[model samples]
Target: MSTTWITRAETAADIPTVHTINAAAFETGAEADLVDALRTDPSWIPGLSIVATDRHDRPIGHALLTRCHIGTVPALCLAPVAVLPEYQKTGAGSAAIHTALRSAADLGEHFVVVLGHPAYYPRFGFTRASTHGIGLTIEVPDEALMALTLDPEHPLPAGIVHYAAPFGI
Candidate 1:
């Protein structure tokens, strides 16, 4: 595992390598396929797909934030975060996630939704979404679906989350 903190956007050359990393990091191919499809979808938000690299700038992890909706309100979705098996727990995934969120904040994005492990995301300031009146169109465990108010001034949006075409949501 590498201790490097560098994170950057995925280039054309990195896409296939990223797909392999995602497929290997997870038990299923869904996430790997999502990454590939999102690249061509109209919903693909440039600069929002990120990869964490080692000292040589070789990608070792990925974290993607794409356009999604909470009711009629625009929001970012964090999904398909994957780290190479060899780099798991090395902070590479976390670094990529943190960087993507921070860049979103700087771009003036206010809200983000995530369907992820209940234990992992809260460390990044995510909270139970229902407390903010946020609900999903699909049935999901209350804790597994979370919302984060990236900008304290803008409260969390309330309603269903509709992901992009690539997500099959």
Candidate 2:
């Protein structure tokens, strides 16, 4: 198990490996299929889809950031983060997420929303979205939906999140 995972923006060649990671990480193919659908969705932000690779440069984790809206304000959605089952607790997923968020920040994106584990996401500076008056139209566990402000100057906006079509939200 390599502790040092290399994170980078997804390249054309990494697509298959990414798909496999999603498939292998989740019990169903829904997440992997969503990745495929998101690829062609208008919300797709090319460089925001990131992967974490092993020492041999084989992708073992994936993270995607796509266009979404918080009220009328532009924001990003972090979804379907996956790490190979064998690498579940090895920080591969974390590296991919940190890298994707950093890329989003560098690209001038301000707010990000993620429907994920409350305990896990907080390490990345996420807080319950309700704290910022954010919510989803669809029902989700309150604590599972979290938000982060990439830029402190621009606080998270208040509104229902509009996820991409593929998300069916």
Root-mean-square deviation of each candidate, in angstroms? 1.0, 0.6
Q: What digit string (tens of lDDT, one per residue) describes model 1 on residues 53-97?
A: 988888989999989999999999998899989889999999999
Model 2 residue runs over 4 Å out of place are: none
Clashing pairs in 1: none
Best by lDDT: 2
**Estimated TM-score for each candidate:** 0.96, 0.98
Model 1 spans with C-alpha error above 4 angstroms? none
Tell me which residue pairs clash in candidate 2.
none
In model 2, what lDDT does residue 140 have? 90
The whole-model C-alpha lDDT of candidate 2 against the native structure comes to: 0.95
Total clashes, candidate 2? 0
TM-score of 1: 0.96
lDDT by residue (tens digit), candidate 2, 126-158: 999999999999889999999999999998899
Candidate 2 — worst ten consecutive residues by lDDT sum? Answer: 51-60
